[model samples]
Target: MRSRLALPIALIAAVSVAATACQSSSGKSSSDAAAKDAPKAASSVADYNPQPYDNIKDGGTYTTAGTFDDQGNPFNVNATLTASRVWSWYNADAITYSPTGEVQYNPDYYSDVKVSVEGGHQKVVLTINPKAVFNDGTPIDWTAIEATWKANNGSDKAYSASTTAGYDGITSVEKGVDAKQAVITFKGVDASWSSLFTTFLHPKAATVDNFNQAYVKKAHPEWGAGPYTVGSWDEHSGNITFVRNPKWWGKKGKLDKRVYVNLESAAAVNAFKNGQLDYTSAVDAESLKQIKGLAGTEIRSGGSPFEYSLNFNTKSPILSEKAVRQAIQESVDRPQIAKIQFQGLDYKEPLPGSAVLHSFQKGYQDNVSAVLKYAPDEARKTLDAAGWKPGSDGVRVKDGKKLEVGYTLLGDDALGKATAGALTAMLKQIGVRLVIKKADDADFSKILSERNFDLFLSGNRSMDPFAARYLCDFYCSDHDSNITGSGTPELNKEITATTEIADLDAQNAAVNEVEQKALQEYAFLPLFSGPSTYGVKKGLANVGATIFYSPLPETIGWQK
Candidate 1:
């Protein structure tokens, strides 16, 4: 049975609340610091103006930092795409984001069905729309939908390890009256299953043979259901450009051409400022400030569901101990990190509350903030109480072993490295030895998957809460979910049930209980929750550009 812990605020990462934290200087009160450094408000909203097509070129390229390589190699059709690029080509079980952080998906535009919580589970029912069609001109129907699942996750023996792994409770996908209606049965009514309604439907004919040979390798095989098709590829440059689908199933092309270029941070910014690129998204605070003087450039501030955090490797004996974990958690100075490390650009409180785990609602900020903050003295006492003795080097030693914690830092971001250094320095003062290692993204992921590090910085961007399902699998004992080989069976069972709960309230309740228990046990440390900043070029109209920062549709194109 799932443990019933206290109801915490539902921050996407933990507890639930819709409070906002103002960015301020490190070590000062948030209110006092924000007052001094805040930027002046814009005088007035600019009038809308649309740019004419004749004035704009049909094909213009843009370069951005951060590689879409994590989206999975397009060369490997058998690979499961994990980034936003995958979601752009294929739909999900459901869409969880909107232009304004709403929880509902626009079914009319994205799907023919409207889903809601019923009987403690999300029932899959459809609303008939005669207009929806596939790129091949095939009328959108239940057969195509069912076939897509079978080819990916069902027993057709074609593909395995799909996005539908989260929807393990799905019993069958069957056709209903005529071809338009479909019935999806589950083992139980699940409110969480509402997340599975926006899946990308594939053509039965294309995937019936072999996905790799027939679909992926072939030049743009007819698979995706979006408004664009895979366009040109530059092997040497490491880029994939997309073109407007002349036969799009949804709204016709709003932007002329969308190109995704993978380059280093400095080069990308240089390209943007020199007019070599029209628009670029996902610019951090420092990059935003660098190009503030560029003509026609405007920086748009927004919040993302992405949570940046520090993971404590349960495999290490010292970290494997509960008291040491708590001591580390207690020592983090969030206010200082927000001001000095993150430059007052990120959300001030890291684990303020839990509502973030459920929805990116506006009112859910502070419920969790009150609980998580720096208590350095408490952290020191906790370490001492745990029988750790300070040695000549000022590092803690217990049972003849030194408390040497390793943290892997990606060399790309300066702020990230600075934050890591600050954390290492702070920990050292408390008799804890922190060793920081530098690695690229791919190597870090490999090390993390192999459970080779004592600690590291990692994050996830997803509106759906299922990503949290992997938490228990990361450290639960004797369980394949135990990626760290340090999981305890009792804690594993507590989190397992949180993922499978059918009732929204009950599931949330269960998750809260597990988090409290995990916090008590110091299972994983939570850091700051913040936004992915972007600089929007003036006069360029786009609706959901940040939605696809890692690469997919480059920008929701509109002329100003």
Candidate 2:
């Protein structure tokens, strides 16, 4: 039998709640001194050893820094990155993909998963564990499966999902031979089937209204099924606490409590210096510098599956012409931008070539070098050939219109601001005026949702190793997340072809073809591919920086 642990789902909305209320009070001052005096340790970003359960010590509290406000609702389409991080602990998935792209199943939740294809249709059978149940005593069976499918399958307009790539292909979900088994049938062969079910909602809360509005400021811990329960939430301080669940049926988790504190990029580093944050990502140059000399801290760096890119709003008048978009793509110097962003850091990323596959992933091919080359001379020539002529002020003019574009700075992060400044200077050399429009983090989503920018710096993190999952989500014409508006019938057909191939090699080849075509059209400009860096408190094992692997909460504790 697989070990089971209970996890929390909601925040108890009280601003005055003390962090000590959830765990034994060590008193903040003494704990801070001890944290500063602890022995230092280090790990690499490529390392994926989750410490053996036997080596982990029991009964301790861990605190970490997060970027965004909690959404509470993981199923919501607009859920923040921090919410996703928190969900990894509180929610259970049938299967999960590792940082190195290994797929493993959670035996505590499902006994087995079988995949088969017949008559051009793919089917998946999931066998839920008999003893598994939500905190409210609801069986983790067909109702949950059906609700998950209905909410994410894209058949209904009411249900809002982050991405409908895999779920949209599902035709039906029916009960299998037993009450604990679920039989899912797809409309056609989908090689990305494993990507679905990373998150699920209860049947009662799967409705449109409940999924969106019900969890706005509330956390319904009753819907959670992990090893911890919602202890307290101090909204004013942006601290959330999770305590051990007495009803957990599996091996007792090592940590007595877990706390996630919301802090901005720079503030998070200061918190770590003050012995408040146990783990925090060192994303910018300044954060990396501040943590270098910190005692009892370890800096882990590696190549990340995430990449930043300049997304073009093809519908905008300034970027409507294909030649103009191609020119803008060729003008920007990705290497220089990478150098500036990661100046003092140990890791530096190479110019990214593919939008679908990162350089570290298998089957990655350099498709952008031929089309999106960084050559300002070539960019000027392309613009001149496309009826855009240099004006007296050195800005391009085409048929009484100026070749000016607006670049939206989503967050006031140092890396983004530096990139924008560099890009503004580079574009001017090619007779294109780039305007930097600053947008608050809170308003960034609204701007993207309304498609109100000509160009923006954005990125996508692969949920799975398979590149097919990203094809439709990022490039499909009708996808809600397709802000570029650059999809075509041929591109759509090529993307669909990748999903139909079951073999990994064949699917990768098909994806490369799609990427080449997309890059030729200048769909989106790929920047650098690098890993997320973090400063972790030494002795805290399996709780720091990671790429693909979501650390199991039960396995995270002080090293014995």
Candidate 3:
């Protein structure tokens, strides 16, 4: 069996937060009781197990809520969460990450995978299953590996990959011991080799134009190779239906079909209440209220390896000063923000202290306690010391400039609005004006890609427990995802060093060092860490809120 890895942070942003209101039979709030009964923060992968795949009954269509309105090309960096979910359902990777964070070969895609260092060069060999073929009848082979490498290695400016972190280190990719094998060589030792190939594109669609625009408003089922295929997509109704793929070489999936319904959080909650959705992640108080006593529904909650924070654009004139950034970081009360955002949800989180590793993960440390403590007075003092004094309007002014910051809100969702409002009110206490900038719903991805804001509220969920997998793209100066523009040469060097470490323990130590420095410098503001809450149909097996294992389509079915 192939271990399913957690979805990337970008994909998690798409489906991690959909839920509806929950109320008891008597119309009373159930949040208080739920909160009291909530389990402790998860410490190991076993804490999040949903249900055994063998116990599920075969053949049923599972309907769920999705966050993206359209499913873009999975290969494109601009691909939405909905696209990723669909892609994962209809694709296989050469290797997969186990819920316990170990790298393992996918029996469905590869026969074997090995990594070694020869002559100071990192080498990876992947043996593909000769019988495996895409829905389009293209045999899975070295060509697909080469295409994935070229498209993501940063060697070609035309390919718009989500991130070039692991692929950028590759020196070459060639045929391995046989036609079904791929031997990839890297410039040096790279620890993120296993993290690549989560999604594969057909060799025919490897061109720059095809990668960037081919699947904009279209999905080609023929190119996908999973147990399920895209059966129909109703753009107007915001529903996508997936049926079993005839060309799939793996065992028949338990569910014959699955449907993803794009909905706003509120509508999703109502849909769940109306028995339209089998599962919905209820993150806010309102959504939690609506699903409390739904028949045959179970609420599953566990720590998520997701980090939500305020990303500061270091290039902004008003925020160029480290003091100003530090002041802003200290002024806003994270506990208060979490409180307001999760109000009535019966959930509260501890202050997060690391950008890379979550508190629930091993080697976790609170490195930002000194700098991140909530202190509006200290923030005012820091601004004053930095030569910013209060003006008649109560906003700080330095050199004839007011201390103002712009924040981009990606959607008009209630949670986002409440977060922005809370942040605006909190910043006002320390003479900082937070200007809320709402991005057009259709242009959200564009605004994010253009890095068009002073402070952007976003989060990334770690797909693997290895923090090194994210160091390059999250903080490296050359990466497109480093919106902060705060990457320093020293920081980059340290982060790069982690990729070269062969031992996991040493690599993690180096990661901790880098995270500490980044947090201390206020590279980004760490908010509280909390678990994702989900209301799942009681008998729906092999699926629920989890950070370790993704709910595999083949294993998802109705419980007998």
Candidate 4:
């Protein structure tokens, strides 16, 4: 499950939130003192214009720019964030999020959600709203929940699951008082039990082939139940149009149609300028300038729950050695990249220290600095010690192999392209060859599932406030979402055990300790935090960045 994670309307890496005391391997915050000296954009939450439901007009068409990838299926283990975002629009959400990151059951899908401790096991009773029905008229019931659990609980390896963390903890998902209620029982106590069952898969999709292979290039809108359903999808242009579901039982959607077009950063901005798109990314200097003096559009800026990181494919030959990965991270100057990234935007932040928590968030600490730092000279020495010798071409060579790494970049954003170019030069200084591959927005899911690059630069955007949930996502080798391939059986056991802790703080601390060990493997390097900037038409409401809150389509439309 994505747990509702994705980059919408042109990807932009942003910030995080949590109350954590994650320490470095040395058991201390290595950069807390340095953090005290800098200004931070995360001091404020996202400023997406919020208006009451009554304030939105009854009907309109809201078209926005977004990436479209052939992600196989929304529930496929190899599914990309793009696929998840598109799937979300046409599916019923079991839960809804407030702008401040609070989770509440969506009454449209559930009549009641009861959590309790029965026989020392955390149990959840979800009462499905009887009025809820899929587009195909399949009644929403325990069968669907059971099917989702069976496919994602890692019980059958043939069925590819994104992560078996929350699902693995469940002992059984049986019918409750009736078919409308699902009685979910966990093996042990889990404080974050509410995080699971956020979305359900169709009971008919329980087969391995259907879960993993059969749905590529298919939205399968018939299996979905929500306010909107896919009206049309253009395979050539990678564009999709959604219309109100004729069989929807909930309140009517505010807009008559929602259109998502695959547009690169430059093209998205141009489209927005020409009134073709309702939303466009402007987080970087160059993109922001394109809309500087636009009369009808405004830039919305504030904290976001997206975080940027470079995931090292440790299974690859060159990066198989932890030392090489560490050296590469040390050679890259993050501050230089940040300065270039936020140059003209004036978005200030202390050097980011944690991939899961931003500086302005509660319990935020510097976990990255103690493990790695920008020291090109030291990095060179480390590479030399690791048996990578400088060849006549100036690139490092070991065992007749050059220390070359492939980096996959998506879209044609000027700032993203420039950043990749800067990274190429930075790695060259350390005698490592950085080969760049620029791909279109539509190829993102393909590149990720194929592992086509040694280094994948992307953001882990969150839909919930629980950062501890990602421990398994990033540290369990069997978890398909752990793209780094650095997880071990030992780490997986530790993370799974940590999730069972009854206290939130104890669970967080235990997860942090295990995280410290996993990160030392050097397969993941933390980079930028936030200041999510988006150019939006003035009257659009309940859309754009709202920190971690994702509003339903029924609540987003043109302001009256």
Model 1 lDDT per residue over 1-560, tens place: 00011111111111110112343223445454553443322101121222333333344433333223432322222222223343354332224434343345544333456455555554475643456565567776776656655554434444422333334556777776666776776665555554454444456542644433443323332545555666766655656666777665444445556666665555666777787665444334565566666778865544445444566777676688878877886776554554544453433333324423522432232323334445667788988999988899899888898888887776556666667778888788788888877776455435644667777665444444443344443334643223345556787777666666655556666666555555455545445545444455665544222321221232345443
Which 10-residue span in candidate 2 carries the lowest summed lDDT? 12-21
lDDT of each: 0.50, 0.69, 0.70, 0.74
lDDT of 4 by residue, 1-560 (tens): 66534331126622222111222222233434434544554544667789888899999999977534555455566665667777778886777677656777889998998889977898889999989888898999999999998998888998877767678788999998899999999898867666666778888766888888656777788888899999998988888999999999988899999999877656777898898988877756766788867989887877766667788998888888988998998777676566556666655566556655555555566677756767788889999999999999999999999899888777765557777888999999999999987777667656666766688777766666665666777767867777778878887888778777887666666756777777788888766655667788999998766876778778899999
Model 1 alpha-carbon drift over 4 Å, by segment:
1-67, 70-82, 86-96, 100-111, 114-122, 127-166, 201-221, 281-285, 344-352, 355-373, 464-510, 543-555
Superposition error at 413 for model 3 (Å): 2.9
Q: What is the lDDT of residue 260 in candidate 2?
A: 82
TM-score for all models, in order of appearance: 0.74, 0.89, 0.89, 0.90
Q: Mind sharing the TM-score for model 4?
A: 0.90
Best by TM-score: 4
Cα error, residue 260 of model 1, in Å, equals: 0.8
- lDDT string, candidate 2, 1-560, tens digits: 00001011011010000010010012222233422432212211454335888898889999886422434565565564556666656666556667767877777777888999999899999898888788898888977888888887778877656667677788898999988898999988887676677557778778888876776656677887777777887767767788887766666678988888877656777888999988776665666778877899887665455656778998998787889998888777666666665565544334567777766677877677654556678889999999999999999898898889998876556656777889999999999999888777766446666888898776555556778777776677776677788888878888877887878878988888887777776758766555556677788887543556666677788888
Top lDDT hit: 4
lDDT of 3 by residue, 493-535 (tens): 8887887887777887888778677666566776645666778
| Candidate 1 vs 2: which has more TM-score | 2
